[model samples]
Target chain A: MKKWELKPAKDLGLPATERFRSLRRESGLVSTGMQLAWWSMVRGYMAVWHRLQITGKHHIPVQSPFIMVANHASHLDALVLASPLTWRLCDRIFLVAAGDVFFETPMVSAFAAGMLNALPLWRKKCGPRAMGQLRQRLLEEPCSYILFPEGSRSRDGQSTGFKPGLGMLVAETSVPVVPCYLDGSFEAMKPNQRLPRPRKIRLNIGEPVSFETVANQREGWVQIAETMERRVLELAPRRGA
Target chain B: MSPAARDRLFGFSHAFDNPVTLVVTLVVGSLLLLAPMLVWWLAWTGRIDRKMKSELITRYWSWLVITPLILGPILLGAAWTIVGIAILSLLCYREYARATGLFREKAVSAVVVLAIVLRSFAELDHWYRLFVALVPFTVGIIAIVAILRDKPEGYIQRVSLGVLGYVLFGSCLGHLGYLANDQNYRPILILIFLSVELNDIFAFIVGKLLGKRKLAPNTSPKKTVAGAVGALVLTTLLVMGLGSFVFRGTVLAGPGYLAFMGMLISILGQFGDLMLSSIKRDLGVKDMAATIPGHGGLLDRFDSIILVAPGVFHFINYFVGVGADQSVHIFTGG
Candidate 1:
């Protein structure tokens, strides 16, 4: 008889409160259902209200263990970037959200963890430990990530220099990092806006960038970040021309 | 629905009518009150270390909270009892799925959950045929759903795990809720729940004091042959003592019959615990989940009850039918 392959849940034994903030968090039926429902609603809202469109949709790979790094602009950037993927992928994709904002309170933490399926990145206290955990999860679970490498949302709709923190995840690994550009999400829902406006939004996915040759060090991370930033910026058309 | 059925379904007023319910309720209530005093005395006398004392206190507090939730529904009505069991079935299923990594198979898990809900409906409607039929029906559905994924590499593993999970948490545990179909379900249920829980306590205490010769060292290191025998004797006595009042007029009134039922409760209850132990041993986890403060998951606390529920239910069912005189198809009338 083949013995039962007993792989207990990765996030088992953690208390509920600890589960929300843990990097080892894994979605079960409830979180999967919630993410599906929430993402479906976001997809619908983007299609109707924002007139969302995606080019180079085929650029996003069908498999996981990849990072979807996009230019941070508005709150809608992550939603717009992640809303187009199939629900199967969406369930595994964790949006690396800011810990201070999304996870400060219990209610928001629940929404962020349950609906958005986000793993928090404590910018203030974010060190190698946090990044190492994220890196470990990406390789161990062989999961994908949707994160803004600029570290925070762009205030004036202009993409900034990509932070090296993104390197901490994909550097020295075979995991592909796909650079993406979000157009008009800033106009739709800026950082200060309480509600998003009905503005047409477009997503441009660039080719997958590999950092396998890049060293897993500070300099290599910076190189990976800069290359990804240049690629994402290249996806956006020149303004007014 | 008939007035009698309505009364049984929603009759909070008659909750205390049965002496078994009254005695069990009072006894459980008193235990809840007196446990803390015992803890404090032990702590005061410095009999237990701080860590052990803290763990015991935490366990007691959780019991204080859990006792009401378990009793409130039964006291309210059979309908509430069924609903409560449905919730428990769902929670237990969730814990099991997560532990076995079966929750990732969304389709099979969904079917399992759907089967559980449907069984709850059957119990509520008093539809015995559907309640009984759900087992094979769900197993077939889970098998089919597993194939829908189209990846056959680990197809057998996935389907079998789903089937086992549904059988353990969904079908087996659901029998406890179905017991509410009996007109005198409150006391019958109280009796079963009380004896099953006390059986665990007996085994634990006895095992601690007199336990030698590990029953199944690979499955459960702490369990002893001596403890198993002790629990069997004590639980059988407790059941016979308390069960006499509940089954006074039934065919199960005699000492011989009562003793048999008690022995079944004790033995089956221990087997249920061993079943979970085997699962945990295979999985190499201590507790199912850290849900309760001092205990493990709801599954850990209620693992023994899962098998005991069906065992006792069917045993009594064979003797004197459950809900024999009660109205059938209370909701979906033929």
Candidate 2:
């Protein structure tokens, strides 16, 4: 019916839903009133993004929890991604951030740890040692998570390749990852750009990619990354497209 | 045995008419009145940082919407209190266990419920000793025995830790129940509660009426020396006058003593409040629990109670712990 509805159906182009299943991923956010307050603020911030309007939000099940993954093109990616999910999920939620950057500042650290549900990704601390506990946190909490598979910011305003790290996370948790693309945020604020333009931005979220569907296919990682890039390419500015 | 059993179970509410109990309650209460003012003074004088705000909305929702409309009257009244208290204890225990991660693998809910039930016995004098024994001993044994089957690692150590926490945080606090209807005990409870109440009341009125200086700009922005004074004044009045009602005029005291003790309790009550606030700041929890819509958890309500109980207990003992007739019904709460 609406862009929001179509976007969820297939627009973001994901390898499999499990690649970004929010529930199957680790929940590092603490649910607190302060967090809930900040979450609402983040939602408002997303609405002002290109005047985005949500529809058929209920297509997302009220009871069933899912995983959320999106193409990270700008700093605003987490807010835009977490916003729609907040409107849909209505419970404790979180996003994965680099432990080195987000967890370093006291204020940001408090916000991340307090209730925004931030999980830290460290390149140095790779493998099961990290995956095992993240897996446990997911099982223990009925929370949804938002992850950017690229792990770092993408320059030149395009979705980067999906790293094996993301696929590894998919294998361990086996949760659905809903691939989403930002139509205007890359240009709204890109690499080396300290500020955003007043132009309208659109975020297209796709149905989840199931890990079960992609687990055996090792080649699926590049295919998944390329698929995410292709979907965002569809939503890119007409000139960028 | 039927009447005898019921009689043993439920003692009629009682009080004392003595010099010792009366003086103790008065002096302890008097100091409570002065506490908030001193705190306000510090905040106004730029000593304690005005870092925190009242966050009144959250508290109002808890007290007005949840407690009064849903759980409060039940707790302070008939039939519902036992269950209310159990629920309260459970939530408090949940917050603690979840925060500390001490009893990570154990079912804190079931354990809290069991502890609450056993602790309830302490309220009934007939089973007081049993209540104390149930926690550190009986529950301890049962938990150890139960865990034996699982053969959990550090079996004895885990059970001991769990039982100790349950006893300290859960059951030992049950002594609040013994406070219900006892006159001798009521003096201390009343004085302490009144003084703490006075802190909020006088601080509000005085701060509004005459406050000119902010005590602690960084720690607590709104507090003032004037507000602290207001709290002290109100508590002194209660210590000298409201107490007269409790004593039926027999609890004699000079106005000077009343003023002096009132000042003391006012100070202590404020100390208690600040202590509670500090704990919340450390843990980063707005309230102890979300159960009470406006009031907060039992910990929140009992924040000052922890300090007031022992403070006024000794105060009542010193003031009203005298005279033949007064001692007759002392523990009986006659």
Candidate 3:
């Protein structure tokens, strides 16, 4: 007879706000309900208001343990990148957001964790130890993540260089990184704007890139980030020539 | 609701109608009042160190909050009592599910929760038939719901966990809520809760004084055989003293019957405590959750009452049936 497998929740004793920011966070029955409700509302809003269009839905990975990296140009980048995924997968997918903006206050942390199902990336203090914890959660839970590699949202609606910190997450793992580009979200909701405008947005998803062969080091991380950046840049629409 | 039913449901003026209720309330109040002085005395005499002193004080503070939350509802109305138990069932199930990792299975968890709520509704309606029927019906539903997953792997584990959760939290605890259907529910509930809590206190104090041999070391390391025997004797006496007043004119007022009921309360109350300890030991957790500051969890504090509720209810029920004269199906009007 096989042994009965019984494992308790990782974030057992932590309070609500602490659970929200915890790297060891795992969704339970209540949070699953919350995610389903929040994601359905976001999907409806994106469809009706943003008139969001996706060019390559096939490129989205079928299972989790993957990363969706998009060009960071607007506050809506995370929302737009996450909008196309199935609501059934909402509990398994987490949007990695800035700690300062989304998790600095208790109220914002609650909103981010409860509604968005987000984990904080403390950019200023994201040492190797923190990155290692994030990596551990990804592979261990085999969950998916949605992140913008350009660190912060763009003020002028242009994609910046991808940061090498993205390398620390998937440099040597079998998890694939899906490159995506979002156009017109900066106009829809720029960093300076309080509310989003009803501007049409287009999402272009490219094939997933694997870095299993790359060494888990500074040079390998930079190369992986650069390659991912170029793939997202390729998805942008051609300009008049 | 009928006038009679309304009176039973929301009548707060008759909170102290029964002599037993008045006596139990005063005793609880006096204990709470005198607890601090005792703690201070212990601290001043160096009977306990700083950590033990702080833990004892913190536990007292938690009980201060918990006692009122529980007693207030029963004193207010049967409706409030039923609702409070329902909330407790939910919270206890929440802790259990999270600890067992059954919360990951959303479908099974939802079914268990729904069954608990529906059982509470039956209690509130005073519908005895529906209340008793919920256990098997829910067990069947939980078993069938897991088959919907279609994966067929770990189906036994999922179904078994769901059933265990519903039975312990929903049905066992629900018996306490169902007792409120009786006309004299306030005094009866107060008597049972008071004795069960005091049972734990008796065991702790006695064990500290004369505990040498361990009762069940693997299951509960701190429990001693001496503590169990001591609690049985003391708690039986307390129950008989209170039971005589509560059942003054009934057949249960006899010495033989009162002694049996007292023993039942102590013995079953100890079993309940050991039962939760075995569960925690198997799961490899110290406490269920840090819900009550120093008490570990609600389950930790109330474990003795879970089995004692039904045990005492049935024993009294066998000799002189409970709620036999009271109205049944109060809201259903059948």
Candidate 4:
């Protein structure tokens, strides 16, 4: 007989708040249910409120161990990107969110972790160690991530340079990074806005890119980030097109 | 529902109607009140160090919150008690699932959860036949739902974990909830809880004073042979003394029957503790989860009650029949 293999939850011993902020957090049945409900509601809201549109939907990978990187402009970017995915992927798809914004307070942390199914990234103190753990979880658990390579929401309508932290996750690995472009989110809900307007939104998903040959170092991370940024830029609708 | 059944379900006015309930509540209340003084005395006398003192205080605070949460439901009404137990069953199952990696199999977990809800419903409706029927029905459902994944690899492990989870958390703990169906459930549950908790304390205290030989060192390093025997003797006596009051006029009032029931509680409670210990050992974890501050997880604190619930439930049920005189199919109106 084969030996029984038991792998306990990675965040088993952490307290509730710490568990929310930990990169090792894994969603159980309750959180999964909550995320599904919340995401389904978000999907409906995006469809009705924003009249969200998608292009190249078939470019999205159907399996795990993939990364979806898009330009960060508004609070609704993650929601918009995740809305197009199938319901089966709801539990496995984690929106990599900013710690200070999403997990600063206990109540906010609960909402972010429980409803959004997000894992925290402490932008101020994000070191290679944190990135390494994220990379390991991405490949080991074979879970997909919805990331904004610009690290934070863009204050203005223009996108920012992609951060090297995104490269650290996919570099020297076979995991595919799909670049997506989101339009009209900035106009709908800017960083300073409290509420969103009913502006039409569009999402264009580019083909997935791999960084298997890229080194897991400074230059390689930069190269991966630049390549991803270029791919996302190529998907954006040209001016007055 | 009849007035009697109504009183048993939602009648908080008669929380202290039974003498046993009153006495147990007072005793638990006194213990909670006096605990702080005792801790202060120990700290002043320097019997325990600062770290140990702080740990004890943390545990006390946790219990301070936990005791009210537990006693409130039992006193509120049978309906609340059953609901509380159902919630407990779900939480315990969640911890077990996360620990054993069983929650990953969403289909099997959902079936187990649904079965537990159904068990709670059966208990509330006072439908014994359906209550008994659900065990097999759930097992069958778990087996069927597990195969839906169509992945043959590790099928046995998944099914076995799901079944074990259901049996331990849903079925065994469900018996405790079913006890609330009886008219005199408040006192009976209080006695069982008191004895089971004191059984652990007795074992720890006695083991510290006189324990020399280790009992299942690999399973639980701290448990000693003396502790097991001491708890067995002390808990049995506690039950015999308390059982006479709780079971007053029933056939279970007899010393012989009470002794047997007490022994059963102690033995099964110890076994339950050992069972959890074995699980933790196998899974390479110290505590199930960091739920309760100083005590580890809810499972750690309530492990003794799990097996004891079913054992004592059946023992009493066979002798006197639980909820025998109560209205059946209260909700369904059959």
Candidate 5:
């Protein structure tokens, strides 16, 4: 079945959220084995991230309808985020990814959309068009959006400041901007390394500061960003939910 | 000779020569051959996608057809066809490695070499004694030696750990040792191979037509109460009546025993298939390695062998009347 409605975690009940992502093109009519497989994948990835001890989850909206701004640490940041949030949120969360990166092949896109539920982000000069579409989705449906705060990935995997559009989107939505700092990913699969090591990583989620606060107070976003930076530093060493 | 007539006149070649071998091979080879057509028919009807369909045919059906054709009356090698299983186990392990990320890269070369070494020795005169001791001792030594190397950090541990999967996954191929050494090796192997395939076919045909009740939806969603009984009844009658002609004196101890054994083998085969499916479920993969068209991998294909082996092995052990400690005197039938 084709679904027109993009639902947020807040709108969906816990079980409903868990089941929702499993919906494919043949969503309702899939085989029993496939359905089992979908849910099992969702559960397994979440368990792995949870076992990695992602911290500051306590700071997230038990239900998220906010702008999640994090540094781009690795190619698999989407999956890493998916693995944890699929467990944490009570609803389906969407990540904004560069369209070209994942859309080259047909089956690949279908599968990513089906599994990751990722929405498109534009890296091209006219990226506003993609952001515009995202803006509409957020307004029409109660949705949480994950944004890579840094426009481009930091060469060294350090926490860099906001990309212009991310800050702009944060201002437009007035949603809480939760800064998440990730540690150990750069070392695990360094840019030069061909394969990833199974290294422990921490996702440091900070207390949500409203867009209004950052806009009204000069340097408030930076303070909020600093608070986030410090929080990730604190969260990195601890292995917990 | 033209290929079709050659296939026909040759009676499908080496794997199905003797009357005992022919009957068993007919049952086993045909079922193996038919499985993919059924999958294609299922796919043609839009049951599975193009990716799954192609995967099923190439990975499973191609090997299934080619193995029996190339190996011939050696259809008994259902447990381990030379080029087919050797490659199949490697593919199965590749899927395992990819899914589990257990072995990493460093472990791949060493573990694969050891596994193939074991395969090369599969047809040795003393395969059973060699396999039983060699697998245990060689794997242990390899693990210790690989671990001691310390080629890189995390490499050795992963290599050493890979031995578990290599052994657990590849050991089923060792059933060839038992198959070869059976005094009535050709018939017994073919008989059991066909019986399992028959169990699957009967269960599917009967289950589809009559199954209304769920047997174990959690483990095997397709099976049903009616299907189970139908398989039991069909296999006992069909297998026994056929076995009487093909197996001759060893057909069955009696109708009662044949029915009992047939029913047990059906259940065992079903359980084995389901067990492998469950492993895929746990590991979050589909079709072990996409090696076979309809079947998943060597592990997937031989899922029944591990369970079926004990039953057939014990039955042979008891009938051959070898005391528990005695080496099996493989009844070599030409």
Candidate 6:
């Protein structure tokens, strides 16, 4: 006889307020339904408003346990990056959002967790422990993440140097990190803008790269970050073209 | 629909027509009013510490909110009572699904949810035949819907979990709603809810005072044999005293029959509590969810009522049929 596997929800014991902010939070039927509806609406809005276009969509791994790292310029960066993926993967995909911006208030936290299906990354207080938890979830739940390697959105349109935190999640693991670039998002919705403009947006996805040989140390993390940064930057259009 | 059926479904004027309903309402109201004074007295005597005092007050506040939500619907009419039960069924199933990891099977969950809605419709329409048929019908649908995933692995587990969820929450709890079909449903439901909740309190108090031996410690460590026996005696007596009025002039009103019904409520209520405990032990979860302040999930608060609902429902149904004089198929007339 085969023993049955019983896995309780990871965030089962937490209070309701804390559950929304917990990294271990898992969505049930209601939250999943909400996310599906929210994402579907967002997809429609993006198509009509931004005239969103995608290139190299085939580069997205058919299965999960992968990471999608893109340049962050606008609040719509995560939405644009996630819009092209199949709806079947909606529940398993978690956007690693900024905790302070997305999760500080109760209403916003609910929106982020319930609608966007985002997991918080506290940039100010984040340490290796938080990064380690994210890494473990990616490989164990075999789920995918949509993260911004630049850590935070750029003040100006120019891209910033990729932070080493991105390497902490995928260093020396078989998990593939697919580099992506978002063009015209800064023009559409800058960090200071309250509402997004009706500018067209383009998403360029590059082939996935793995860091299995790289050591799980600071130097290796920095190296992986630089390589990913270069790959994403290369996908962007020429500066003067 | 007949005028009598309309009166039972939506008429609030007759909410207190039954003396038993009036007494139960007064008793619950008095308890809520006196609880704060009792807590203050305990605090003054230094019998309970500050933390315990605050916890007790928090629990009392939660009950204050919960009592009105429960009694308001029953007072309004049977229609609202059925709707309330339907919502409770969905929330309880949600907690169960999340705890058992069955929520991951979206297909099976959708089938279970659809079955619950259908069962609610049956109850609302007062369609007894369809209400009874839904149990097996839903189990079959769950089995079929689970296969659509095309993955045979864990097929039995998923199907079994879905069936059990539907049976426990959708069907068993639905019986409580179905009882509203009775013309005297307000008093009957109040009696059942009051006794079931009191049964838990009796066990706790008696166990604290005189309990020595463990009663299935592995299943529920805090439960004692003395507590169970004490509750069985007290609750049976409570029911015998109160149930005579609720079941007046019916076959169930006899002393012997009422005593038997009381014992059934107490025993089955204990079993229901233990059943949820066993599930928690299996899943290694303490409480289902932190829904109610100081009381854990709705399942945790109302676990005793689940089994007691069906057990007491059928017992009365057998002796003197439930809703015998009330109009049937009120919404879906033949």
What TM-score would every model get versus the actual structure? 0.97, 0.43, 0.96, 0.98, 0.46, 0.98
Model 1 spans with C-alpha error above 4 angstroms: A1-4
For candidate 2, give the lDDT of residue A174: 48
Q: Least lDDT summed over 10 consecutive residues: which range in candidate 3 chain B?
A: B325-334
Q: What lDDT score is found at residue B264 in candidate 4?
A: 97
Alpha-carbon lDDT, every model: 0.90, 0.53, 0.88, 0.93, 0.56, 0.93
Predicted structure 6: lDDT: 0.93
- lDDT of residue A40 for candidate 6: 91
Model 6 agreement with the true structure over A1-241: per-residue lDDT tens digits: 4568888888886887799999999988788899999899999999999999999999999889899998899999999998988988989999999999999999999999999999999999899999999999999998999999888999898888999998899888999999999999999998879999999999999999999999999999999999999999999977688
DockQ-wise, the better of 5 and 6 is: 6
* lDDT (C-alpha) at residue B65 in model 6: 96
Write one digit per residue (lDDT tens) for candidate 5, span A1-241: 2322211112111222233322211121122224336546755654564345567677776555676766677764545555445443322366676656654456655554555555555467535555565555565555777767565566787766554565445543467767677676676666667776777666767777665546623355455555545544454455585
The alpha-carbon RMSD values of the candidates against the true structure, listed in the order shown, are 1.5, 17.3, 1.8, 1.3, 15.2, 1.4
DockQ, cand. 3: 0.72
Q: Show pairs that collide, candidate 1.
A: none
Among incorrect, acceptable, medium and high, the docking class of model 5 is incorrect
Question: Tens-digit lDDT track for model 3 on B118-223?
Answer: 9999998888789889999999999999999697788999999999999999999999998888788898899888888888989999999999999999899899
Instruction: Please state the CAPRI-style docking class of candidate 3.
Output: medium
Model 2, residue B97: distance off in Å is 7.1
In candidate 6, how many Å is residue B328 off? Answer: 2.5
True contacts kept of 5: 0.00
- Chain B TM-score of every predicted model: 0.98, 0.55, 0.96, 0.98, 0.67, 0.98
Lowest lDDT sum, 10 consecutive residues, model 5 chain B, at: B325-334
Q: How would the candidate models be sorted by TM-score, starting from the highest? A: 4, 6, 1, 3, 5, 2
Clash counts per candidate, in order, are: 0, 87, 0, 0, 19, 0
| Model 4: lDDT of residue A194 | 95
